[model samples]
Target: MTSLPADDIASPTSTWDLVPATVLSTTETDGPDRPEPRPACEDVRPVIAGHRLIGACADGPRAAQLMFVSDAEGRLARAAEDGSVEPGCTLEELAGDLARSTGRQLHPENPGLRRVLLVRLDAPELPLLAALSGTGFTAVSRHGWSVVVFDGELDYWAVRTGLDETAVVLSSDGATRSFEVLLAGEDPADVTELDSADAVCVLEWGPPWQPAGGLPAGSGRTPAGQFEQDLVRLCAGGTSELQIESVASVFDLDPAETNRLRNYVGGGSTDLVLESVLQLVGLPVLAAKIAEGRREMADLEDARHYEPTAMGPALLRGMTTEPTGDGLMARYQRAVLRRPELLLALAGTEAALGLGLAGAARRGGSGARVLGTLSAALLADAAAESAYWATVRRARRGSARAVPAGLLRRFFGLPEG
Candidate 1:
């Protein structure tokens, strides 16, 4: 394995020489006409050279910056506002402008003014790929979220030989570390447990075909296979640690429980907060209770020793509307044991669920849709919480898991819903 300095990492395909670029801020700029610079919206799909730059930034110094044009409305908007379609600040021009303005060569304090990022959410838009990559903003994981370069510094663990390759990206305090493992030609099917460390891991198929997105084709997956795939993608590609931590904050989970849930979700557990809440409500016990009636419900609740709350009941009811993983409700009881707050967080479960659902909706909608339907199930759970547990109480033998996954679609919301 070779350690490479971020600045020294070469772009394998980009031929254009690195040039200076201007850095601008919407917030600091004095005029009302200024468009505030945000982390260049995560939409760019980069090629090899651009991908390398993104990886370098993620693994580079926390302060290392990449800049970009903050405009999203395109040349029409630019022309309309500035009376010209030509760029206000080209990359080279921006670099020089930034240097002169900040008086620190490039105003090391601000990174976005330097370039752009590779952050496509769906399939790659081949046409916009190069232009986006060329800007040099931070490259995103396959999931289309901004990859934050950590503050501390980076270390390399690249492997030259063939192995069941995996890349784990860890982030803390605006710092990130990546671990690239070569499994020495190990069977791709073989399970490779990630180190228990807290960092997010981005698994790469490595060597054979490093997908530009870093997520290999995951066609048909076994339960374990799916778990592994989810684990890697959730951590490496989708959502950042801070994003998940923010969701946890809505639940008022303590530092430890919040971290555990964040890492679990980062490791690819979907609907984690919701599912954990269901366990708190004793949804799975509905199946057994059907056979023994009220006696079993009492016994089961006693053993678990927890009072039902709005969260658990709501999640249970909402999930009952569709239920392939209904059996997994039993799994939550175990999780509560590991992290008691899994249930305790339910004290404010309704508020937490609402926040999570709203967060999902805020993520945006599909091409034709107006609302973000991706997380509609969470919304359904929130709306149906009042009725979910009552239905569970009336369930009979084998009835708990009876609902099909399809039923949940009614709540999935707009676009596809």
Candidate 2:
């Protein structure tokens, strides 16, 4: 596959900071680490179906019965024969063909956003794929889709690298163990031999190497199993080691954590929840605190939660609040919490940028106007994050605090304080 030159790829502002490692990778630390880079296609089943292949590679399943990476060069034709699989049509054309052949356009299959993808066929290395495959089974899923996301996030098994643009993995029904390529909507695809007397071909995408767009809005927010919900149940039904093991397997409990968990269960103490398990494993409570801090700030920002009477007191201000979750907001807060000095630093940085942009804003050029607008936004971010730190500090504690509502109201004028 011909690599897109740096100049050819359109980059968003967020990506500009990345010091890319390869022609395609988003970061300097990333790139194809697998040998026989022979490009990513030929590394896998060469000549898939009847078309020539390149930069394709496969890994055993992580979440599914048999999983493989359909890299930018890999997405499958799910062929009957194993020679180069070629895409010969758009997704609309192929879907239309299937509609004609099957006598109906199959209803859209929503692979609930809790991505069952266990494999990072998109990983930079092949061997690491096997090693890291078992991970993500218990991770918190963000809209970006990874278990590594901060708490209260949508739980997921793996981060999807390029689901829209390629066959990121071969997912079986887990019951049939039979692989089916279900590419929906419209895009370029390769369905080589549906009409052939003796061949099978199914799958397609808009373009190779170019990941055109993201999953449709609100489409990537669902949880896979009731794991999030089951966490609630697991906490309630802490009766047997069997139940413990079952949840652990779903989460792919870390070996050490798993051992400790068994020891915990064996000790005969019940009443475990997701929070308890996280605590048992020594995963930091800081993650939850950070999430709480962000949620608090979001509440403060929302007009619906505003109480004029509570304006003077910090505690009441928080009481009448109902902040919806914003993972991105949480992400920014998490980063600030990790390196708090950066939050302070953001102020000075924004001030400096604001000074620079003010003159440009006065000049009235479109580029300067854009820069001025972004600078003002940056300033707002710096201010919000600075204020956010106070909430986090108030949230900080070794254990839950209570029993001071009246005292705080009388002395501090903030009952919740």
- Top-scoring candidate (TM-score): 2
C-alpha positional error of residue 198 in candidate 2 after TM-score superposition, expressed in Å: 9.5
Off by over 4 Å in 1: 1-66, 69-88, 107-163, 171-259, 263-417
Q: Report the lDDT tens digits of candidate 2 across residue range 1-417.
A: 212222321222111111111111011224477422122222112222122211211221111111111224323222112222222223234335434543333122312111122121111111122223322222222222221221122322222322332221222211111111222222112332212311221111111121111112231122211111222232122235554554455446787777776665444222122224446533433222222222222232211211112223433233222222233333443454455667567667776777777777878876876878877876666675466455444545322111112222332222221
Tens-digit lDDT string for candidate 1 (1-417): 111122221212212121212122223345888644332112111221221111111211223323221222211001112122222333343335434544323332333211111111111111122122221111222221222121112111111121122222221112221121112353222332322222322211111111122112342132222322332342344445654554444346677776665555444222132234223322232221222122222333211111223333423333432211212332332243234343334424654665665675676655313333424544445445434334443442234311212232333221221
How far off is residue 162 in model 2, in Å? 15
TM-score of each: 0.20, 0.23
- Global lDDT scores for all candidate models: 0.28, 0.29
TM-score of 1: 0.20
How high a TM-score does candidate 2 get? 0.23
Task: Please give the clash total of every predicted structure, in order.
Answer: 30, 20
